[model samples]
Target: MPEVRIKKRFSALAGAVLAAALVIAPLTAAGASAAAPVLGTVGTIEAATSDGNHESYWQARYASYNATCYKHSLTESTVHGAVTDGGKTVTLAPFQSSWPGNGWAALIVNSGTSNNVIVKPVAGIAYASPVNNGGQQATVSHWIVCKGTLPTPPSVVTPSLTFTPASCLAAGAIVFGQNVVWSSVKNADGTTTWTASPKAGTVFPANVTTSWTVPDLTKLSIDLEGCRPTQPSADESETVKTTFVCAPPLATITTTTTKTPYDVWDTTLHKWVAGTATSSDVVTTRPLTADEQATCEPEEPELPTTTVDTKPWVDGSWKCGDTTVLQTREVITTVTPTEGEPTVTKTSEQQTRKLTQSEIGTCPLVPGKILSACVGDVPYLSYSVDLPEGFVASSEKPVTITFVNGHGGEDYVVTGQPLSGKLLWPGASDAEPKMWPGWDLVDGQYVETSGNYAWTRLKDVVVKFRVNPEYETTVTYPEATAECANPALTSVTPDDPTDPTDPTGDPTDPSDPAPAPSVTPTPASASTDNTLAITGGTIQLGALGLGALAVLAGVGMTIVSVRRSRKA
Candidate 1:
C-alpha cells in the first residue's frame, strides 16, 4: 500500500507532528465504495489501493514515533494492528488498545519495532462503518493513530547486542557410545537459544525418543535507556530454535565372502604335470602326485617305441649239421613200442670198391685210408705196398698228404673236402707243395717221415682218396678216365681197378701213395664236378613253411627258394 501523504486542509489543520510512519493495507471489503477515504476511520484498515506492497515492518521510519489505535466493538475486540495478504498474516505490537468502543489507544516506540499481535477479531466477525466483514457491516469500530510518511529525522537511538551463548541444539543423539549433548545459549541482550539434552551425566539408548524445550521469550528483557541518543537501538531479543536428534538407526552392517577353486595335475613325464582346474568357491590350486596325475591328464604313453630290425640274420644248415639261427624252433620225437621184436635191417651203402691194377688187391692202396681227396676230379691210379715180413705201421706223429699233378703243374690240398675212398680220384689243382715220407724203418719202428725223394720227378701224380660231408656213407660214383677234354664227361660203368704187379727192383717205393685215411663215408658223385670244396648248405626254411606250401600245392609239389649272398 502507498503511504498516505496527508495534506492538512484548513478545517483539519488541528494537529500534525511527524517522527515515523506506517500505512496499514488489508484485503478488500467485498463491494463497498472504494472512494478516497475521508479523514474517517473504516474497518481499521484501508483497502489495497493502487499502491505498491509493504511488509509488516515499516522500514521507512526515520526516528522514534508515537502510535495509537482506537477500538469499539459489539464484542471484546482482539485486533491490535494486523493485515493479511490473503494467504499469510503479519503481526505487530500487542500494545493494548485501552479505550472503550470508539475511544482511543496509544504507544511510543522507535524505528524497527516489532511485537506479536492477534491477527483478527476472534469468536465473531466485525468491521468499521462503510467496510463490512464478509457481508456483515461494522459491528466494530476501530481506528489507528500512525504517522503516514517519513518525517525529517534528527533523533536517533543506538544500542549494541551480543548473543552470549550464540546458539544450541534442540536435542542430542547417541553417537557411538556417548551422547552428543547440546547446551543452551543466552545473549546479554536478553535473547535465548533453546536446546535439549539428557540432563547432566545422563545417557540414552540408541534411537530413543528425544526433544527440546521451546524457550520462554517472556523471560527475556531489553534495556534501551542506556543507548546514546544518536545510535540505533536494540528492539527486543530474537528467538533461535534448532532441532534435536537421538541415535540414528544403527550403522549399516555388511558381511563378505570370497570364492575360489582348485587345480589338478597330469602324468606321463614320470613326474606330475598340470591339468584343468577343479572349480570351487575359493581361489585354490593343488600339485598332482604321480597317482593323481594318472587320473587327471591323458597318461603319457611309455614314450612311443620305434625299432628297426637291423641286420636280421640269415640262418642256414648244411646237409650234415645244424647251425646257429635267430628265430626259435621246436622238435618232437615219438617212441613206439612194438609187440614183437624189431628188425634192424641196416643196408649199408659203400661208396668205394677195392681198387686194383693188373691184378685185384695187389698194391692195396686204400684211397682214403688216412687222408681225403677231391672226388669230382679226373680218376687216377695211386699205388701202395704192404710192409714186408718184419715191418709195422705207426702213427706216432702228424702226417701230411700233398697232391702233385702231371705236366709239371703245382700241388694242392684236399683237406675238409668231399672225398670218397673208392670213388675215382680227382686231379690236382694249382698251388705249391712239400714232400712227405713213404716210410722209413728206423730203429725197428716204421715212421712215415716227410722229405723229398732223390728220384726223377714224375709227370703225373694221381690220388685215390676222396671225402664227402653231405652224403655220408651212402655214396657211389662212376668210373672215370683221366680225360676231361671236350668238357663232356663220358659216361663209364663203375668198374673195380685190377692192375698190380710185383714190387720189382726200383718201382713203388719212391712214388708210393700217402698213408691211407681211416675211411669215413663220402657223398655220391659221377667224378665229374672237379671243384668240390664244401656243398649242400641249402636250408629247409622250416618244416612248417614247407609243409604248408606242399599242402597248398596239393600233395605232389614242393616250393624251394635259392638265394646267394656274399660275405664281406
Candidate 2:
C-alpha cells in the first residue's frame, strides 16, 4: 500500500514537470534558431509569489536495500523514491552532486530517487535518466520536475516512538494513538512533497511523543521515506518505528511430578509460578504416621454366639365331623437343636486398653473390677460405657484408656470418632460407684501411675450423649395382689358355666364337667313388641318415613278444618 502511494505522488510531480517543460519548449524554439543538440532539461522557475521563508542547511544520508542487481550498495536516500516512474527509461539530465567537499560533479541517481531536495535548490530540475552506478543493480535514480524548489518540507515533526507496554511475549503491533500524520503535497514544479506519517500533538519543528497499545508481537516495522539523522531540513515522512516491550504468557513447567519442585496439581502452571514461593505449594494430602495409625481402631469385632432350633408342640383339638360324635386329631412336632462350641480368635489391634495382668482385656458392664473371689465373694466391676444404637456421637472426652503392649510392641487404641468436651484427669471417679482394677486404681482410675504411661496414649474418650427428652416414654406398673372374689371375664356371657362339681367354682381342673346354663323368664319381656323403634341419634328408615307421612297428613286435615270454620 505504501509503495503505491509513493508512485502516485511522483507521477503527479512528473506530469507537472512535463507541462512546464512543454511551456518552456515553445519559448526555447522561438528564441533559438536551431534544433536543440541535447535532450531537453526539465526545469521550473519560481512563481510570481514567495513565502518569504527558507530551508536551513540541508544534509543527506546513505541508505540501501538489495540493489537492482541483487547486490548490496549504499544509495544516497532513505527509501526508494522518484518523481516520475523509476522503472522507465529516461534521457539524462545534468545535476551537481556536492558530496561533502567533492564539489559539483555531474551525477544522477539511477533506478530510484537517490536524493530529495530539502530546500528547493535554484529552480527545480530533474534528470531524464537514472544515475549510472557501474553495477546494473546498484543504481539510484531521482527525476525531479519542480516549481521554485521542492515545496518546503511540510513540517518538521520529531518521530516519537513508544510501545503500549514496551515488553511482552505475544505478537506486538503498532497502532496509531496520537500524533500528526504527514501528507503528500503536490507542487507546481511537477514534483510531490510528502512529510512523515503524522503523530498526534505534533507541532512543526517540535518532536512529539504518543502511546499505542501494541498487539501480541515482539517487533514492529515502519517503512517510509525521508527520515535520517543527517537530514534536518524538512518534515521527512515516516512509516513509524515503535519499540514494544512484550511479556508473553508464562511457559509451562515441563518437570515431571516426581522431579517437580512444587506439589503443583497442574504441570502447565509450573512455568507461570516457577520462580514464585507458591511454586512449592502443590495440592497434596498429609501422610498417616505410624503413631497416628495406632490411634485408629479396626471395624467392630464379630462376637461369638450360638444358634438354637426348637420344634413347637401343638395340642390335640376336638372337632365335629359334620355329625354326631366329635373326633380329635393330634399333631406332634419333632424338635432338634444344633449344639457346638464356637472357635473364637481375637485379632490384635492398635487400641488403648485398661492395664491388666492379662495381655488382653474386655470392656463389659459389672458392679466393679473383675474379681478373684474372697470367701465365695460377689465380684464387683465397673459399669460398661457404651453408645446406644441411634446415638450420634458428638465428641469423646478423655477417660483414662489403658494402653497395653502386646507381643508385638505397643498398642495405642484410637477410634475414628472425633473428640469433644475437655480432658479427664486423675483421681476422678466414674459417674457411678464402681470397683476399679484395685483399690489403688480407685483413686487414679484415670491417672497414669507407671512412668511408661507417656509412651502410649490413654485415648479412652468418654462420649456424652442424649436422646430427645420429649420422646421419653413412661410406663405404669400395676401392683400385684391376690384376688379371692372373681376374675373379670372376657368373651364370656353371664350364663357361661363355671364348673359342676367344684363348690369353689375353680376352673383349674380340666376333667370336671361343665355346668348347664340357667336363665329365668321375665313376664315383662314376654309382652311381645317386634317393632324396631327410632331412638337416640338413630333413625329407623322404614319406621321414620312412615311416621313423617302420617304427621303431614294430620297437619293438612287440621288446616282444612280451620279454613272451613272461617268461611262458615
**TM-score top scorer:** 2
Model 2, range 268-368, lDDT digits (tens) per residue? 32111112221221232233345433333344132222112221222232111111222222222222222445443322212222222111111111111
User: Candidate 1: deviation at residue 334, Å?
Assistant: 42
lDDT of 1 at 215: 34
Q: What is the lDDT for 540 in model 2?
A: 21
Give the TM-score (vs. native) of candidate 1: 0.13
TM-score per candidate, in order? Answer: 0.13, 0.14
lDDT of 1 by residue, 374-482 (tens): 2222222122212212222243221222444433645443443222212122322111121112323344333443322211112223332221111111111111221
Give stretches of model 1 more than 4 Å off.
1-311, 316-367, 370-403, 406-568
Q: For model 1, what is the C-alpha lDDT against the true structure?
A: 0.25
